[model samples]
Target: MPPTLQSLDHLVLTVSDVDATLAFYRDVLGMVPQSFTPTGGTARWALTFGCQKINLHRAGHEFEPKAKMPRAGSADLCFLSDTPLDAWQATLAVHGVLVEEGPIRRTGAQGPILSIYLRDPDGNLIEISNQI
Candidate 1:
């Protein structure tokens, strides 16, 4: 027998403000809020976009105080979209999301691809890439 693999289940990110992060993911990214809870005085919000579920957990308390700035170019998670590169870029721009640079051409394991990268409010990198 061989080890079988399943699809990605979720991506969790620690945020300074859960409400604001939820708004960005929901309002800007057009994801839907799936659930939220306050555990031990910190809020946890879950959102769904397409098949991906993103969990935002509030950080700032005795157990989980604020963290240092994340490493530049470090992605908490990367999301792929079937939407055209230009359209996605325009959409991000409209939401005031700054593009660090790209839609650059590159060769991937699967073949050629185009990608653009940006950062969220918490300084988490997000790359929007598509096969070219």
Candidate 2:
């Protein structure tokens, strides 16, 4: 059998502008932010929610050799939120982030989820969902 996996720890996102990405996630979506310089490398920022986090690496300066084909707008990710879908949309509006699409039905890892889709500054698709 393949090795069993636990929860996700972190994911790396190559971004065109780290500051913009950080602001969108931290201010618009409410992720906790942390900045660090590992060992003796360039600085990086991470936006965390729940127990998982996304590390921002500038497009040209990733830590070591990274993803086989990493690009600024390459990821499409989904997240679970306890807030109602309508409230989530309102929050996005307050932050001036446009809704790409949703509040639609979707399936999640746990079960049925009500999801709202939005795009990050890098154009990465983000789905914010709640259990239904």
Candidate 3:
């Protein structure tokens, strides 16, 4: 039988500047930034939120076994937030993040969701949504 997917564990993001990307996710999106080293390996960075995480690889210095076309500013990711849309607007305002589009109705994986779209430091599209 073919395998079925259950849930997402993590994903990788290619970034231009690690510090800027880390700062945006950490300060603007409330994700926890972490740094760790593999056994006999170099340091790596990740951003954690809830049960998921995003591993970071520098654009010109990606680790081994990476994407065939690893490029910065190439990802579009959506995140589900329990926080209200109004609150999210305020938070974005406080952070000076420009809204590319949204606080509009959209279809989500489970159901309808209200979403707001913006760009991260690496110009990756970021969508923050709340189930309605």
lDDT of 3: 0.94
lDDT of 1: 0.71
Candidate 3 global Cα RMSD: 0.9
Name the candidate, 1 or 3, with the larger lDDT value.
3
What TM-score does structure 2 among the candidates reach?
0.93
Model 1 poorest ten-residue lDDT run? 61-70
lDDT of 3 by residue, 1-132 (tens): 999999999999999999999999999999999998978889999999999999999998998889999999999998999999889889999999999898899999999999999999888999999999
User: How much is the lDDT of residue 90 in candidate 3?
Assistant: 92
lDDT of 2: 0.89
lDDT of 3 at 121: 89
Model 1, range 14-114, lDDT digits (tens) per residue? 77776777787787667898765556664456889888787665654212443364232235455666888789888888999888989887665577778
Error of 2 at 8 (Å): 0.9
TM-score of 3: 0.96
Determine the backbone clash count of candidate 3: 0
The parts of candidate 3 lying over 4 Å away from their true place are none
Query: What's the ranking of the predictions by lDDT, best on top?
Result: 3, 2, 1
TM-scores, each model vs. reference: 0.75, 0.93, 0.96
